[model samples]
Target: MARIRGYVEALIAELRALDDGDVWMLGGGRLQAAFLERGALDDIEIYVMPEIIGGGVPLFPATGLRLSPKLIETKALDKGCVYLRYNFS
Candidate 1:
């Protein structure tokens, strides 16, 4: 756990040092959870599809931490899909 945390910290530091406009974590709930746990995630974008498969990996896993990010934007896409954007408070 300590090693993982160290790696996460290093990764975030490197990302912050970059000149890129925005860093995106495409997928992986666990990975996202890691960043969230470390307070490294400034915002998050979630895309909701029309189909539901009943069971699948959660957008964020249970880490005993709760967050209510401010909803910045929402857009309805074609085929009943939706895009949600939120920023951490």
Candidate 2:
């Protein structure tokens, strides 16, 4: 987040030139929560892959933030991966 934080600061400057209708792509659910805590993000996407990760790095961590997700879409991607997008707002 250190490097990304620097870019986000840059974004704060360039955001003045935006049309207020642009969307920024971001990953990292936990970091998203941090941004939200700092009032940077309001909407989010939570994608659950079809295959289970066997004892690897986990996506969602215990951030002490709880939210109810509303299902927005589901998709079957390449390599037998199924994606589930939820509205975190």
Count of residue pairs whose backbone atoms collide, per candidate = 0, 0
Q: Name the 10 consecutive residues with the lowest summed lDDT in model 2.
A: 34-43
- The TM-score of predicted model 2 comes to 0.58
Model 1 residue runs over 4 Å out of place are: none
* Per-residue accuracy of model 1 over 7-83 as CA lDDT, tens digit each: 88999999989997888787678888899888989999988996778888667778898988999999999989999
Model 2 over residues 1-89: C-alpha lDDT tens digits?
68877776666557646888856767676566655555555456555455566666657666676667677888877877777766656
User: Model 1: how far is 44 from its true place, Å?
Assistant: 0.4
* TM-score of every model versus the real structure: 0.83, 0.58
Error of 1 at 82 (Å): 0.3
> Which candidate ranks first by TM-score, i.e. highest?
1
Residue pairs in clash, model 2: none
